[model samples]
Target: MMEAVKRFVGPKWRQYLAASLASYGSLCTGMSMGWTSPIFPQLRGPNSPLAEEPTLQQESWIGSLLVLGGLAGPIITVPLSRYIGRRWLVMGSNLPLLLGWLLAGVASDLPTLYVARLMWGCATGMQFATVPLYIGEIAEDHNRGALSSLFLLFINVGFLLAYAIGPFTSYWGLTACGGILSLFYVPFTWFIPETPFFLVYKDRNTEASDVLKKLRGTSKEAVQAELEGLQALVAREFKEEPKISDLWATRGNVKALGICVFLAMLLQLSGIDVLLFYMEELLVKVGTKISASDGTIIMGAVQVVTSCITPLVVDRLGRKLLMWTTSLGLTIFLGLIGVYALLDSYYNYDMGSWAFLPLLCLIIYMILFTLGVGPVPWILVAEMFPVKTKCLASGIASFMCWLAGFIWTRFFRDVAASYGIYTAFWVLAVCCGVGFVFSATLLPETKGKTFDEIQDMLNNRSKEPKPVAV
Candidate 1:
């Protein structure tokens, strides 16, 4: 049995398995993000367990506080991962997530629930900033794009699980299921090796070589050659500790940071967090015949299916094409939604007969979103920066993303209350249009390129500053 297992599990199996384990962290994060969708309405419903039903103001805080915690994740994760290594940090993140779910499962008051969510948010922040770094270091060039995309795939899976199951379970039951995810993730993630790049950084060349061999399923000579190349690349790029100022110091650095920050802003502005937090409410408001919970599940299913497409085609179709295609699609769908909402509100046009329209549009919007804006930004963040500056840049970009999410999630109810939800959809549509323009004119195609090659392209493009037409 041992011989058969050894023969069957090839060298690349280790890389695939490690990436999968890292993705489970994303699963937990997604569960945390999606939990409120089901629980919020329940807490406000008469069957609620709270001493008093939550007001809209309190509910908004519950929805937005996770982003607040996420905003703090990068501050700690960047330095922690740098010192202790990515694998341990990844393993350690599960503890807080588990605790968060446990607290949510048995909480007698809203304050306890808030603390639970904040803990989950912090774990999410750590996962987002660190998982990509780990995957980027371990994956071979040929499989890197697909492997990195798995992070998003698992996230959508978690979202789907939460939405699909939340309506069927009691509050504590749902929380228990979520906690089970973290519990399983903890032990499984323990076995994956630390990234070869980090090992080399610590001057453990021999161990790096062994890890490379295991990851690549290659012979000793091939592993040695790969290790030498990595050593040369690291030596050339990482002479000093990376600084925040390095993001602004050089032309390439400035351009990379600008694109990443813009992408992060565009991601949140596109309304993902809004949709996740309020999908059930939005569906109900649209007067869909479908139950709010059912609509949310359907949306989650669409997201998972579409997100799965990205890993298969990201390397083949290249990042630029996917970005533009999905951005344009999002723009059209969001615009239609805004138009529908406006017509229903002002013109008193009865939309009940066509209630399915908003649902259809939302489902399509989620599909396009998961395909492009959802996963591509993280992939680009992992790809665009130099190794030395990658962690800092990723942390800064992630902070921007969570901050935007915090603002949007916190204020969306106010905006909808004041200007109408149509206005919110219109605003998101405009953001999508802007993102399309950025992708067409500014973003470089990084398909099949080595890290050095990508850096060279950015440097050369920075020198001339010409836009690449779609």
Candidate 2:
């Protein structure tokens, strides 16, 4: 299987390695989020300065503030990359994340804690915007989908590690151990190269060609052809500086941007964030006595195990098949979880048999959700846009994703409180149904096409005929 994946991936393997490191960074961020959440309760115990209260207001504040910071961070990465290059910008963004983690480790007040989370949020948003961009830029038409799926795999790994550690926070003395672990990323930024597209755009063709040769390890003739193809594409698509408003001005871009934004909103409407952050609480709501923090570790373990399969299957199954199938599966699993919660709330019969059911359903949901929408949108948003508007378009799309995330976190507590868990699951089920319709009609297959081919496909412009292999 490893050899087969390598064979199918062709010459652009090194680029994928770099993209995977960025994916590692993304995974670390998610792990950090959940890892920190369960420990907040510990921090509030009698020994610590804070007091533990599972209040909706406080949870909402933490979730929404991080999202708000995510909303604001990625908008600037486009121009900054254009000016300095992808490598430096990615490196520079880590400062805030590291600093925030350090601050949170020592934080004694609610305001200080919020500030640390805000910075971490900003780091996460920047990763969402830029990692896909970096991967998409360096990938060949045949392997882009596979390369992009790496994001999903590593992040799930992070989620799994985060959950696994939540149960051990007391053993480690404080959650500060996790935050300090996050700070180790500060040195990795120096090791990766600037993306090939950034090199070419700055008129450093020789350098770009050199990087291409090293990354591809193909014959000089093949390397030259690939470099020329990239140069021509970049020169043709991005000859002019992209304006932010361009995402809305033209019909093609508007359709493109609309699809991306709606998809982002749709991805969140699945309630993945709420499920992830509060998985323990939701499990308890269905009648488990295990501590929410310990439950979080179990949730993460399930996510990691399930997510391990996505990268293996994503490229082979094709995007649409994987997406709709997983969406449907998630809807069913969520429905089961909600039903279990409702039953536990209204009835007091034997709860042990049903006890494991909620946990089982949550695990199934994580698996299905990872299989489909979790990683594909980030890859699609990065690939679908023309180089001219790639940054601005992806930025707006990511911003919409974070915005929807904020909405979900803000209302999740109240919805669970008032209507019960069933209502929230029912609402998300309907949203997933709508996403099925939109994806069937609007989301194009981006698996085998080059960026130009995709743009032409989207624009109803024909690709010039290729010579027969003979």
Give per-model CA RMSD. Answer: 4.0, 4.2
Best by lDDT: 1
Provide the TM-score for each candidate, comma-separated.
0.92, 0.87
For each candidate, the alpha-carbon lDDT, in order, equals: 0.84, 0.72
Candidate 1 per-residue lDDT, tens place, 1-470, comes to 54554566554767777898888889878988998888887887776767788887888888998888888789988888768999998888887788898888878788988888888888898888888888989998777777787788889888888898888887877788899878898788888889999998888899999988888877879888789988997788778877778887878788888888888888998999999978888887655668899899999988888877777766678888989888999999999888888888757798878778889999988878877787788778778887778888888989999999999899888887788888888888999999999999899898778777787887884444789899
Compose the digit string of candidate 2's lDDT tens values, residues 279-369. Answer: 6667667676566666677777777676667766776777777777777777777777667666777666666665778777777777777
Return the lDDT, model 2, position 11.
54
Per-candidate clashes, comma-separated: 1, 2
Quickly count the clashes in candidate 2: 2
What TM-score number comes out for model 2?
Answer: 0.87
Runs in model 1 lying further than 4 Å from the true structure: 1-11, 448-470
TM-score of 1: 0.92
